[model samples]
Target: MKHALILVALLGLSVTAVAQTVREPDGYRMDQYRGPVPDSLTGGRVLDPEAAHDLWQAGEAAFIDVLPRAPKPKNLPEGTIWRDKPRHSIPGAIWLPNVGYGAIAEVTADYFRRGLEQATDGNMDHPVVIFCLAECWMSWNAAKRALEYGYSEVYWMPDGTDGWTFFDYPTEVITPEPEP
Candidate 1:
């Protein structure tokens, strides 16, 4: 019994250690986006569900969802139907897919910039909250980019829609803004 108890405690410790091992990268996460993320972002405020909810209640922040939309495969046979997977996010969030990649094309950068301008009415000082799914790096990248674009008040919600909905916050189906 004593040996079994010691083994269980050691296993618990190992699990805890593993859970604590996610480190923030020096720059954007280039790949493997669906994984643990750091607890904080350097230039932006990291928000939990409750804080995000408060922001939502305040009715000022523009919540931007950066979840990527998968493109239809090019190898599909002619006449094969292709449909984009629908995304549901926090109510009022503007879904700006495909702008969170570590390296983005000039067109994508333009789209992101235009989307932010539209959302904030061209006010760089407007507070903007960027998110995707929990543990997703897309939101981190988007938030970082927003900062680089000179947004003064930027918030990173790493918990994303998963955490928001977990707390029973309402969500709605949203479509991506047209690419610029």
Candidate 2:
């Protein structure tokens, strides 16, 4: 009986680990875009990074950062500084790290909601693009939440912040409060 139970448990664990779901660290899944993304902000639609960048350059849209703060640098060595400020913000992207941990705190659901509120400014007609470092998930979760929140134009840069920098685009760096 013990062996049978152990075998069953192992099977379940394997299944869970092998799940095809693009489960984000913050619980965001890519499969969320299978349906309609309402015209919440723009009445037309949200734009991706490229288009959003064009709009930003043209003064039509805004880009946002959604990296959560960490208590200890998840990807950095000991004694690394938290990149919390809102500068080098792609000329227009706002910094809103989601569920900051390790060095970041206070990334609650409400935190996300508030950020969205600020992004749209009580209007669902605004276009916003959320991103962070590449091969990451916080930004993915953020973008999906925006879509679920009914924002019309939310772009999840599959490539992440690296994509932006990789393209040799513009960027800004700033100091953040790290809302503990």
Clashes (candidate 1): 0
TM-score for every candidate vs. truth? 0.88, 0.58
The TM-score measured for candidate 1 stands at: 0.88
Candidate 1: segments with Cα more than 4 A from true spot: 1-19
* Model number with the top TM-score: 1
RMSD vs true structure, all candidates: 3.7, 10.3
What's the residue-level lDDT of 50 in candidate 2? 70
Per-residue lDDT tens digits for candidate 1, residues 16-84, read 555466777888899988988888877889999899999999997999999999988989998899988
lDDT of 2 by residue, 26-144 (tens): 34433433322222222224344576567667776556676654445467877767653444547556677544222223356566667667767867667776666655555555666
lDDT of model 2, residue 32: 30
